[model samples]
Target: MSITLSIIYLISTITFVIGLKLLGHPETAKKGNSIAAFGMGLAIIGTIFLNNLEVPIFIYILIIVAILIGSVIGWLIAIKVEMTKMPELVSLFNGFGGASAALIGIVEYGNNQADITQVTTIIAAIIIGSITFSGSMIAWAKLNGSLKKDIRLPKYNLINNLLLIALIVFGFFIVNGSINGEIIIYILLLFSLIYGILFVIPIGGADMPVVISLLNSLTGIAAAITGILYDNMVMMVGGILVGSAGLILTFAMCKAMNRSLSNVIFGAFGGDSVAAKKGSTIGGHIKKTNPSDVAVLMNYADKVVIVPGYGLAVAQAQHVIHELEELLTKKGVEVSYAIHPVAGRMPGHMNVLLAESNVSYDKLIEMDDINPQFKNTDVVLVVGANDVVNPAAHNDPSSPIYGMPILEVEDARSIIINKRSMNPGYAGIQNELFFNQKTSMLFGDAKETLTKLVQELKNM
Candidate 1:
C-alpha cells in the first residue's frame, strides 16, 4: 500500500512539473491547468484512500461532501467571472488558498500536541497564511474599486515594525511552550491578520500586480509548510512550484515598473492628491483626430502595432481590436499587439483579454520582443493604454515612472490613442506621449472607436 501511494505521488509530481512548464506559454496554458488539476485530484484521492488513518467512514463521507461543495462554488465563479474582473478573481482565489492553509495548521495543532519542530512549522504556516489571506482580500478590494483610497496611518512604518516584532515574540513564546499555547497562538494569529491588512492598504492601485504576486508567493509558502507538517510529497512539490513561479513573476513585474519590491510595498505612490495633481499637469495642446481620419492613416500603413491596457479591458474592446486586426490583415498591412509586461491590472492580463477574442497567439509580442519593431512600423494604435507608452519614463528624471521600461510607440511614423478623456493613467502621471508631434488622440470609448475604425476600413 505504501509503495503504491509513493508511485502515485511520484506520477502526480511529474504531471505537475510538466503542466507548470506548459503554462509558460498562452497556447498551452489551458491544457497545463487541466493537467495540473488532474494531478492534484489524484493526490487528494490517494491521500484519502491509501493513508491508513484510523478515522470513521462518516468523516470520509463528510470530507467528500465538503470538497464537492467547494468545487461547485469555484466552478461557478470561474464560469461567471468576466475577463475584466480577472485580477479581482485571482486575488480572491489567493486569499482562499491562504485561508485553507491557516485552517489546516489550526486544526492539526488542536488534534495533537506537537514537538518543537512541528510547533514551529505550524506557527510559520499560520503566520504566513493569515497574512496572505488578509492581504489578498485587501488587494482584491483595491482592484475591484471597492476601496477607493489608499489607507495609511500616522507613523505607519513604525507601527508596522512594532507589529512584526510582536508577532515574532509571540511565536517564540508558542515554540518554547512557556505560556498558554492556545492563548498565545490566537494572539499570534490576530497580529498576523492585522499586519496583513496594514501591509496592503497603503499600496497604490498601480502596484496591484506586484502585491498580488507577492501574496501568491506567501500562500505558496504557507502551503509548503502545511505539506511539511503532513509529510505529503505531492503537496510539497506543487507548493514549491507555485511559490517559485509567483516569486519570479513578482520580481519581473517590479523590474518592469522600475520599482523595488520594498518601494512598492512602502511608497504608496498613488494617493488622492497625487492623482489630482497628475490630471492638472498637462502643459501642451493634444492633437485630436476622428476615427475616419485614423482609419485613413492605418489603411495606408505598411505595419501597425496595437497597445492594450486596463482601459481596453474595462471597455471590453478586445473583440473589436481583433476585428481591426483582421481588416488590416486583409488589406495587406501587418498588425501585431505590443504587450507590456504589466500592461493591465495583473501580469499577462492583456494577453488573456486578447486570447478571449480568439486573437492569434503568435501576433502578441512581448515588450522586449516588440520594442525595436515600432521604429519600422508606420502607425502605432494605443488603445486606452497610457503609462506603458509614455516617454516620460525615459526622458523625465523627475517623473514617478522614470526609469521604467516602456514601449517606444513614439518611434512610429504616426500614433493614434483611443481614450475616453485625457485622464492620467493608474500611475497618476501625465502622459507626455499625448503632446508628441506624431501622436493624435481619438477620444471615445475604446470599443466604440475601434468599431468606427472597423466600419471605415470596410468602407475603404
Candidate 2:
C-alpha cells in the first residue's frame, strides 16, 4: 500500500511540474490548470484510501459531503465571477486555502500529544495560516472597493512590530512545552488573526496584487507545514510549488514597479502618506481628438501598437478593441498589443482580457519584447492605460512611479489615448503622456470609442 501510494505521489508530482511549465504561457494555461487539478484529485483520493488511518464510516461520509458542498460553491463562483472581479476571487480563494491549513493545525494539535518538533511546526502553521486567511480577506475587500481607504492607526509600524514580537514570544513558549493549554492556543490564534488584519489593512487597493501574491505564498508555506504534520509527500510538493510560484510572481510584480518587496510591505506605497505627497500635477496643454481622426491616423500608419490597462477592463472594451485591430489588419497596417507586466489590476490581467476576446496570442507583446518596436511605429493607441505608459516614470525623479518600468509609447511618431476623463490612474498620479506634444486624447467610454473607431475605418 505504501509503495502504491508513493508511486501515485510521484506521478502526481510529475504532472504538477508539467502543468506548471504549461501555465507559464497563456495559450496552454487552461490545459495546465486542468492537468494540475487532476493531479491534485489523484493525490487526495490516494491519501484518503491508502493512508490506512482508522476512520469511522460516518466521519468519511461527512468528509465527502463537505467536499461536495465546497465543490459546488467553488464551481458556482468560477462560472459566475466576471473577469473584472478575478483579482478579488483569487484573493478569496487564497484565504480559503489558508483557513483550511489553519483548521488542520488546530485539529491535529488537539488530537495528538505531539513532540516538541511537531508542536513547533503546528504553531508555525497556525500563525502563518491565520495571517494568510485574514490578510487575504482584507485584500479581497480592498480589491472589491468595500474597504475604500487604507486603515491605519497612529504609530502603525510600532504597534505592528510589537504585536509581531508578542506573537513570537507566545510561539516560543508553546514550542518549549511550557504552555500547552487550549486557552493559550486560542489566544495565540487570536493574536495571529489580528496581526493578519493589521498587516494588510494599511496596504491600499493599488498594491493589492502584490499583497495577494505575498499572502498566497504564506498560505502555501502553511500548507507545506501541515503536510509535514501528516507526512504527506503530495501535499508537501503541491504546497512548495504554490509557495514558490507565488513568491516568484510577487518578486516580478515588485521588480516591474521598481519597488523592493520590503518597500511594498513596509513602505505602504499606496497609503495616505503617498496620496498626500501626490500634489504635483503634470503641466501642459491637453490635446483632444475625435474617434474618426484617430481612425484615420491608424489607417495611414505603417504599424500601430495598442496598450490596454485597468480602464479597458472597466469598460469591457477588449472585444471592440479586437475589432479595431481586425479593421487595422485589413488596411495593411501592422497591429500589436504592448502589455506591461503590472498593467491591469492583477498579473496577466490584460492578457486574460484580450484572450477572452479571441485576440491573437502572437500580437500580444511583452514590455521588453515590444519596447523596441515603439520607436519605429507610426501610431501608438493607448486604451485607458496610464501609469504603465507614463513618461514620469523615466523623466520625473520626484514622481512616485519614477523608477518603475513603463511602456515607451511616447517614442512613437504619434499617440492617441482613449479615456473617459483627464483623471489620474490607480497610483493617483498625473500622467505626462496625456500632455505630450505628439499625444492626442479621445475622451469617452473605451468600448464606445473603439466601436466608433471601427465603424469609421469600415466607412473609409
Structural similarity to truth (TM-score) of each candidate: 0.93, 0.93
Regions of candidate 2 where Cα sits further than 4 Å from its true position: 1-3, 25-31, 270-273
Q: Estimate, for each residue in 339-374, the C-alpha lDDT of model 1 and write its tens digit.
A: 998899987899889999999989999999999998
Clashes of each: 0, 0
The TM-score of predicted model 1 comes to 0.93
Off by over 4 Å in 1: 25-31, 271-282
**Model 1 Cα shift for residue 331 (angstroms):** 2.7
